[model samples]
Target: MIRCSAQTLVALFILTNITATICCPQTCSCQSTPNVNVDCDHRSLTAIPPGVQAQTAKLDLSYNKITTLLPEAFNSLSQLKYLHLKNNAISVISSGAFHGLTSLEKLYLNYNDVITLPENVFSSLTRLKYLYLNDNAISMISSKAFTGLSNLYELTISYNEITSLPASVFHNLQNLHRLEMYKNKISSLPVTIFQTLDKLYALDLGGNNLTTFPFGIFNGLNNLNVLMLMRNKISSVPIEALRSLPSLQHLHMFNNLLTNVSALKDLQNLKTLKLDGNCIQVLQDGVFERLTKLRILYLQRCCIETVFPSTFRGLSSLLNLYLNNNELKTLPATLFDDVQNLKRLYLRHNELTSLPSNIFTGLPLEDLELDHNKLRHPPVILSLNELHYLSLSHNDLEIIPTTFPIQRLRFGS
Candidate 1:
């Protein structure tokens, strides 16, 4: 009788199991050294190739002509952690299409033709952290679409046609940190839409059609740091909506219709503020008195014609100030007295015909842009020891100062 050795028998059993579970489809490529990964992307196929290796941890099916995702299509890939399906024509998805992908952490569904998200479509992915759904034609999203994504961290739904969102759409995402919904057609939002997202840090709502906001809409987001509302139609900022955001550092509201910013008196910790491309014609005194830590301020192209002497009183830490493309005819001698730490100052394309000789005094300015203005004579910069680059081009100047030492200077007419 022929007797088999124990080692030979164990090897045979392992080979049998491997043969049953490790079969890469003919249209795809697989690797197993650094963990099983399947690449079936960019194929002209219309459906998912069957019999992918069960040990596959990452699968790429992006840039394909796949149109639909049937139920249980990826049930065999239980160990998958990353799935790339962006840039596909997938418009129809069965209810249980992503039913068994429990280990998936990152799912890319951007640049597709998906229009609606049925409820519980991603309920099985409890461990998902990153979800990308940008650049799609999505206009409707079920309120419970993200029901089981409790561990989700970052979500991107930008560049879509979504006009509105259900109030409880993000109620289950308690651990979410960053939520980007920019470049959409959203007109308004619920007052308490973000009440449950206490851990959120960055909220981007730029490039929308929002005309106003409800008061106290941001009360629960205590840990929020960055808020972007640029490129909207808002004419005023409500003080009550921003009173609760104590940790906010950057506020962007450029390219709007704002005429007043008196609501910014309480944001003491603000670092960067962009309010250009608006219609603010005057800067009142004590308007920004509370912004002691502000570093950069952009007020260009605002049709500004007047600025009080105390308009920049509390901005002691300001480094860069942009006042270009306005209608200012003259500036107060002490206009920059409070911003002694300023390094770069832009006052180009204004209506200033003359400047205060002591305007550039006591400043360590590195770059000063005064081009495209109506200045008849350059400002006295003999006290500016650290002046590096000075631009006085396209102005009405017939005589340029030669006493001050500058590395690069532009004084052409």
Candidate 2:
């Protein structure tokens, strides 16, 4: 009888403990989603959980092994904002993958092996801000891939095998900010490729087989700041190609077959200029006459033998000057005449043997790089009191002058 009483007590204790273990899926570690935010990212579950219909704002399901999403995957999630499924095995969505999500802000599906976006996949996401579909096997984006995403800001569709983008792909994304369509088989951009995106800040058209510069294109984009036109067969940029951008800051036109630079003189707000790897042996005398606000200039690996003395006279705000790895033996006497703000001057890997008299006449320079040159003596500057970093080690100099040790400069090879 005592043994039976002890067994009943043990049974009661075990049953009480089992009943105390509550099953809360939302807070349960074994069954909870990746992030427990009101907007959550759920991954690796056999199916979408049930309670996400009321919550979940930003769901990032990238790099998972899910094959299918239920038709009600996001059926009633009213607060959902961003949905990212870039690198997943999601093979199919049952038409209403995002049926009731009206507040979705961004959608990223790049780098997926998906073959197509269902016809009405994004018909309800009205406020999407950014859409990234780069590096995907998506053969085509339904003209409706962005059906109801009226306030979309940026879209990147690069590095894909897309032969052509639908003409009206960006029709309703009127407030779009940036678009990248580089490294695809797109031979020609549709005439209206950038029709609705007036607020775009940067546009890249590099790494294509374009033979002619697309003129009459920037008439719509009046606020573009950075434009990249590298690695194309473009001989020269038309003067009118950029006559509309009054606020352009940086212009990248490298690796093109060009001998003239007059077209770039109209950009008054230009800051950084890169013209390396081109056939520009002699720059226009007033090439940078209008670029007074220029700061960083890179002209490495060009056919420049000697920079014209008056070439950089107007660049008062120029700071970094890179003339390395080029075919140059001497710098013009007036190279540093008016550059009062010159800081980093790079003349490395050139065939220079002697420093010009008054080479650095204008301003406060900190970093001077003259490595890999055949120099036997230090650069003769009238005043290098502000110099900080100096590189002249890999040359024939066995010793430097005691006076060469400026207060802030560091000597190097």
Question: Highest lDDT, which number?
Answer: 1
- Candidate 2, lDDT over the whole model: 0.72
lDDT of 1 by residue, 217-318 (tens): 898899999999999999988888899998999999999999999998899999999999999999998789899999999999999999998899999999
Please give each candidate's TM-score.
0.93, 0.83
Segments in model 2 whose C-alpha atoms lie over 4 Å from true places? 1-51, 67-72, 91-96, 115-121, 231-233, 255-259, 406-408
- Give the per-residue lDDT of model 2 (tens digit) for 1-413: 00100111224445452221212235112222432233224445444544443455565566666667677677777777777777766657667777877777788777766666655577777777888877876657777677777787887877777666677777777787888877676666666767777888988877666655567667687788888877766777788878878778887777877776778888888898888777777754557878899998888877777677778868888999888887677777776787888888988888888877687865688888899988888886548777878888688776677876655567775
Model 1 misses residue 370 by how many Å? 0.6
Error of 2 at 260 (Å): 3.8
Computed on alpha carbons, the lDDT of every model, listed in order, comes to: 0.89, 0.72
Give RMSD to native, each candidate: 5.0, 7.7
Which candidate leads in TM-score?
1
The C-alpha stretches of model 1 lying farther than 4 A from their native spots are: 1-22, 407-413
* Decoy 1 TM-score against native: 0.93
